[model samples]
Target: MATLLHIDSSVFPHGASASRPVTDAFRRTWEEQHPQGTVIYRDLATDPVPHLTADAHLAGFSDPATHTPEQAAAFAARVALIEELEGADAVLIGAPMYNYSIPSTLKAWLDNVILAGRTFMAEDSKIKGTPVTIVASRGGSYAPGTPREDYEYVQTYLRAVLADTLGLDVDFIVPELTMAPQNPAMTELVPLYEASRERALEDATTKAKELTERLAA
Candidate 1:
């Protein structure tokens, strides 16, 4: 049976969050394709993972036998998070843009899982080539040719870490201009937002089914 690691870092709930509904769509489709498959879920907003501490950072580079009690405890927590990523066949993340970047909760999760000589900087990493789909929702458009394109750090930063560094096969479903409906000044962009959102939902469903089929093959 396939295992999916589904993570949602949106501060808002399903109805209010731009990224959560799209991720939920993808997960629902994946579940339909694999009725008995396992899903490991994390809601980072409510139960955020610990930030990388000095002990945790040092533990990754030091020998296990040399770890002090503090390092041992911190590294154990880090290992549990890393093991979750290594064990998953696929990963889905709801990464809503906050201040033109990813949520700090998501960053904290990455810091814990991205260990040197293990998930990163390793030739034969367990998570290498694992499929990962990121739903990157933003309040305003920062796509190519947009005025704020250069400010789009969420995807750029995540790609650097999740794909380039970790060797995961990364794909993205972006829903842009999310504040159009709520913000009076951006009322003109509401139609565009709707279109983008619809497209994201379709992409999520299609990608989910495609990944399931690929995994079965």
Candidate 2:
């Protein structure tokens, strides 16, 4: 069976937020499609990962065989986080746009997971890659190429970090404008938001099924 990791960073569970509900919907559909697949969940809101500290930084840069006791411990913790990602066939990230960026807890988790020579590598003066999906929740509409697109720093930052730093092929789905005031634009966005959510769930489920089937084969 394929292994899928579900990572949620939403502070709010279901109130005016697309992160939790949208991810939950995708997870449900995925499970239905792949009954034999295994799913593991990590709730960053309830149990946040530790941020990168000086000790971790030192250990990360040190040679594994020459690491000190403290550095070894730090390295072990970071290795555990990387192992989680390495073992998974697919990953689902549920994140809400906070101040036009990702939550600090989720950022910390990413720091722990994206380790040098683990999730990424600098070989032949270039980096290799992985794949990731981000289900994002936004309070305001910020479609790409639109006038307000510049306001979408969250998606932009995420795409850069996953693709550039960790060498991950990142896919994003934002169910936008969940808290906007009633207006003509808002009315137009309502159906758009619903359609986006539906497509996001379908895409996630399809990817999960494909991964599982490929692994089985």
Candidate 3:
């Protein structure tokens, strides 16, 4: 059975934030669909990724074949992160939009995962592809063409990093924006928030099922 690596970085639980609920919903559905498949969950909020140091940066940019001991060690850590991604058939990222972008912890995790010549490569000046799914939660609405659309840097940047930098085919499910000031205020927003969470969870499960079938095929 296929293995799924789930990552969640939300600071809040199901009520205050959508990330946890969305991820939980997806995992539940995925488990039902692929009973034999295994799920590995990593919570960045609880156990965060180590920040990239200058030495780590230098090591990543250096030639692996000619790396010094320190550089090699750093490279090894990065390789380990990439290996996690490589070992999994699919990945689910549960992230809440913070300041119009992903949390620093999530970004650090991405930095560790997207290593040159490992997760991706420059083949004939073009990048190949892998597959990833992101379940994003935001406090306010920011769809394209909307006034707050420009605040959607989180999704935009994530798409670019996963696709262009890491060569991953990234899919996303954004629990429609909640907590916006509306006519009905809390009464209307609460239901909308709950509905979005349910939708996100369902979407994740469906995607996992489809992915597992494809892998099996």
Candidate 4:
């Protein structure tokens, strides 16, 4: 059976989080297609992983025999995370924008798994070419020609890391203008937000089904 690594970094729950429901939609569709498949899930907001430390950073380059007690503990935690990514057939992430960037918890996870000679540039990397779907929900529109297009860092940074560095086959489903319904200043954009939400859910379902079929093939 196929395995999926799902990571959710939304500070809010499914009912309130713009990104959570969309990612949940994708996961539901994926599970429906692969009833017997495995899903290794991580809810970063509730159970955040430790941030990458100096010990952990240096341990990746040093010999195991030379590791200090601090390095051993820190690096061990990172290894578990890396192993999860490597073992997955596909990955799904809920990375809602926080202050024009990804959440710190998600960034911490990335720092742990993105080792130089392991997940990044290794000749025998397990995660290389693995398919990854990212749900990048934001409070405002940042598409090309948008007023805040230049402030969009989530997709741009992730594409560079996930595709350029790790060599994953990356795809994104974005739901924009999420704050329109909640923020009075953006009340006029509510319709656009609703439409974006609908499109994102549809995209998530479609992408999940397509990925399952491709994996089975």
Better of 2 and 4 by TM-score: 4
Query: Candidate 3 — what's its lDDT?
Result: 0.77
| Candidate 2 Cα outliers beyond 4 Å, as residue runs | 122-129, 181-217
* True-vs-predicted CA distance for residue 11, candidate 1, Å: 0.6
Q: lDDT (0-100) at residue 151 of candidate 4?
A: 100
lDDT of 1 by residue, 3-100 (tens): 99999999999989999999999999999998999999999999999999999999999999999999999999999999999999999999999998
Q: What are the per-residue Cα lDDT tens digits for candidate 2 across 1-217?
A: 6667889999876664568877887678778766887888899988888888877878887788888887888778888877777777667899788888899999998887776665667552122344466888787777877777888888888887788777766777677776544456577667776777677667766765665565467
User: Per-residue lDDT for 182 in model 4?
Assistant: 86
Query: What Cα-based lDDT does every candidate model obtain?
Result: 0.97, 0.75, 0.77, 0.97
Against the correct fold, how does model 2 do in TM-score? 0.82
Give candidate 2's error at residue 115 in angstroms.
1.8
